[model samples]
Target: MNISHLLRQYEQGHRDFPELNLAGVDLSKVMLISVNLTKSNLMGINFSRGFLTKSNLSQASLNWGDLTYAKMSESQLIETDLTKANLTGAFMVKSVLRSAKLSGANLSYSNLRGANLSDANCCGANLQEINLREANLTGVNFNWANLSKARLSCAVLKQASFFGSNLTDAFIKEADLSHTNLEQVNFQNSRLSYSNLQGANLQGANLQGAKLRYIDLREANLQGANLRDADLEGADLTNAIVDNADFTNATLRDTKVIGTQLKPQTIQKNLSELQLKRNPNYAGSFELLSTSYAVAVFNKDNSLSC
Candidate 1:
């Protein structure tokens, strides 16, 4: 259908356009509020700077399309194919993109606050500096995606996979990442305070200088992970695996370590500092009795006592 005809129909209060083949069409800067384009073929279409608020584009193919700077707030894009699409700086606040395919897409600097991207595939996408605060990303696959400097605070990321993803300097405070797969992911200098990471797989992940205060990490795996200079104050590490993990200079003050085994290297450097504040009068030294156990020794009457 031609753009003029569509506009004329739209002016006549007709908004249903399901299965319409508008391939490579130029609809930039147009207003199409509440329009239904379900299952439409919109490949390579230009919607840049356009207003598509509350529109339904479910199952639509928008591969390699230009949606840069578009206002698609509160739109429905469920299962939409947006692979390789250009969504730079687009406003998608409160939009529903459940199970959408955005792999290889450029969503840099986009505003997706409160959007539901649950179960979406955004692997290898350019999401740098995007505003995804409070967004629902449950079970989303962000493998190899660049999310550096992104704002994802209070986002729901349960069971999500961010393998090898770059999350450096990302603001993810108070987010829920329970049971998520974050293996080898880079979270350097990220702020994740009060976040829930219970049972999450963080093996080989880089969390250097991360702020993890009051976070929940019960039963989480941190094998071979880097926690250098990271702050874990008051964080829960109950039943977590820390084998081969590096905690050099990491702040574990008031952190819970119940049922968790700390590396000898970690205990050797921080054991004295790990003592409870209530026991400040007790001077002691820790001895590695085994690979998984340590013994505290007290110097009493010029004799060592355990």
Candidate 2:
């Protein structure tokens, strides 16, 4: 059957539109609404501005395809291979892209609210300014990806690896980031309010000017993290290692510090000085006691306590 006939059949409520080989076809601006292209090979095809709403592209090969500005809302793309595809400004809200390979894909400015991207490989992908609110991104590999200004509010990022990635100014409010590896990631000016970051590795991360109100950092390794001027009000830092961390001018009002100890007397004193300089209303007498105790411990055991 011809492409036009198939299109008419698709628009007529025919869900199963048999295997069509549009592999190298320029299907840009085509109206493929509600079409079922399951397991089809559409690699390198240009589907820019195409209407693919409620379409099924599950297990399809769309690698290196150009889907820029395409309307693919509520589509089923489970296990689809979209590696190196350009999906910038695409509408993918509530789409199912679970376990899909989107490595090196350009998904900037895409609307992926409530999408299922769980276990998807998006390593080195460009997701800047993308909307991923309430998306299932569990175990997603976003290593070295550029996610600047992305809104991932309430997204499930459990076990996600964002090592060496740039998440600058990203809004991740109420997101589940438990056990995630965010080492060497840049979260400058990011908002992660009420997020769960339990057991997450954030070592050497730059969180300057970030707002982390009520965030759970339990057992999280934050060694060498730069948190200058960060707002950590009501945040839980239980058992979090803050060794060599820079919290200059950062707000710790109502912040939980259970099992988190200052490194040394000199360091504590310096931090206290910094804090006092930052906010004159700060009355932290415990830091002085901690310094004294650390000094005594150092003299007695010949080893500095952390």
Candidate 3:
């Protein structure tokens, strides 16, 4: 209750300021538009370059808070703690931060466009180059988060965990990440075009040079996932597990690979060279099994059976 008596009780207008403690307060560059400061303690507070547009700061503790370069547009920060908070280069557009804890938070280069951060914990958060374009991040945990080069295009991230998260060069196009855990997540050079990742786990995920065009990966696990040089053209990977997944020079045009473990002589020699360079009247049915292994079947009206 210092800061020149909270800026003379907000210049005698007196915007709420519920449960104010204002521990270690500095309130750097304060503007505090539409301020409420709900349940505020604001431990180690600085609020660097603060503007705080439409501010509420719900259930705020803000442990070790700095909020570097803060603007906080449309802020609410529900259930906020912001543990170890710095929020470097923060803007936080359309912020809500539902169930926020923000464990070990740094939020490097943050913008957080359309932010909701549903069920957020953001474990071990750094979030380098963060933008989070269409952010909701449902059930977010982000276990060991770094999120290098993060943009998170069209983000929702349902059931998100990101167990050992880095997400190098991440863009995450059309993101959903259904049933997400992403056990050993790295996602090197990630783009993830048209992403859904149904039943996603991605056990040892790396996804080297990933673009993953038309991605879905139904029943997804990808036990030892790498997907080197990955493009995954028209990707589906139905019933996906891919026990020792590597897909070295992955492109897989019109890729599905139903019930995948991927070794019926490497899916009948890569679907017989993608049916002789993209369906030269390729009627699909194959069974050349003298134990040399050739049993290709990819029929979901995209027919290619063997």
Scored by lDDT, the top model is 1
In candidate 2, position 244 carries an lDDT of: 84
Looking at model 3, which ten-residue stretch has the lowest summed lDDT?
276-285
Model 2 compared with the native: what TM-score? 0.86
Q: Which residue pairs clash in candidate 3? A: 284-305, 285-305, 286-305, 286-306, 296-306
Rank the candidate models, highest lDDT first.
Answer: 1, 2, 3
lDDT of 1 by residue, 162-224 (tens): 988999999999999998888999999999999999999999999999999999999999999
Return the top candidate by TM-score: 1
Per-residue lDDT tens digits for candidate 3, residues 73-176, read 87898998988889898998888999889988898888988889898899998998889989898998988889888999888989878888798888989888
Models 1 onward score TM values of 0.88, 0.86, 0.39
lDDT of prediction 1: 0.88
TM-score rank order: 1, 2, 3
Number of backbone-clashing residue pairs for each candidate, in the order shown: 0, 0, 5
Global local distance difference test of model 3: 0.79
TM-score of 1: 0.88
lDDT of 2 by residue, 234-305 (tens): 778877888888766566666656556644322333533233211223222213224322311111222222
Query: What's the residue-level lDDT of 91 in candidate 3?
Result: 91
User: lDDT per model, in order?
Assistant: 0.88, 0.82, 0.79
The reply for model 2, stretches above 4 Å from the true place, is 11-13, 264-306
